[model samples]
Target: MSAEFDVRYTAQLARLSLTDAEAAKFQSQLSQVLVYVEKLKQVDVSGVEPTAHSSEMNNVFRADEPRDWFTSKQALSNAPRQANDLFVVTKVIE
Candidate 1:
């Protein structure tokens, strides 16, 4: 990887302002990280299954049972303002 290209491209994408010294330092560090990632790609994983999560978890579920519901008056009892039994707020957009 070209360190100079990497530094210039990253600065442009992030709209960052970096001094000459900082640019050079970042170039070297970024190159090292890319090299390490390239090395990691050489690992073999034949017959290995991919998983979204690491832990062994089954399909967790809850019972579908009816429950008591709250009325609008009870729900908005502590609200600052209400109109027609509903919470009211200031207009958000012009």
Candidate 2:
């Protein structure tokens, strides 16, 4: 990538105000990172399968069962404001 393009892209993404010197430095750093990623592309993985996570996992969900729920009074007891057995919140905008 060109230095000018890299600087513009970084500034746009990060909302940064970089000087020419800082842009030059960042461009060099980004170039190095891209080179490292390119090197990774050269590794052989023809038989390897893609995995979402590194660890082996099994579904651990418990069987759904009916349970007692809190009463309305108990549920709203600690609320700052309640109306008609429901919690009330401030309006966000006019």
Candidate 3:
């Protein structure tokens, strides 16, 4: 289960600098990870169905229905200032 990936090349591509000792250490550690991944490949999952969750799931949403909205007069009735059916605001910039 030897990892054959070029760690130095990978480090260079990732914009990292490593000493020889660090590169050797990482190569060994990465090889161990690959060995575990290879072990997972040996597991039998052919009979298992793929699912996003372990429990039964259902959507909990309310039904959508259209209703009447406030008219322009009703919306502007509470405005501090109004002119020509529009809300009047103070000038903010010169």
Against the true structure, whose lDDT is highest?
3
Off by over 4 Å in 3: 44-94
Residue by residue across 8-69, what tens digits does model 2's lDDT show?
57687987888889887987887777766777677898998989887899677887998899
Candidate 1 segments whose C-alpha is farther than 4 A from its true place? 1-5, 45-94
Better structure of 2 and 3 per lDDT: 3
lDDT by residue (tens digit), candidate 1, 55-78: 899899999998889888899999
TM-score of structure candidate 3? 0.42
Clashing pairs in 2: none
Question: Ten consecutive residues with minimal summed lDDT in candidate 1?
Answer: 1-10
Model 2: which ten-residue window has the lowest total lDDT? 1-10
Clashing residue pairs, backbone N/CA/C < 3 A, model 3: none
Once model 3 is optimally superposed onto the true structure by TM-score, how far is the C-alpha of residue 71 displaced, in angstroms? 38
lDDT of 3 by residue, 1-94 (tens): 3556778988999999899999999988987787778877778999888898878877768779978999999999899999999999889897
> How displaced is residue 5 in candidate 2, in Å?
6.7
lDDT of 1 at 2: 42
Which RMSD values do the candidates have, in order? 8.6, 7.8, 14.6
TM-score of 2: 0.42
TM-score of each predicted structure versus truth:
0.41, 0.42, 0.42
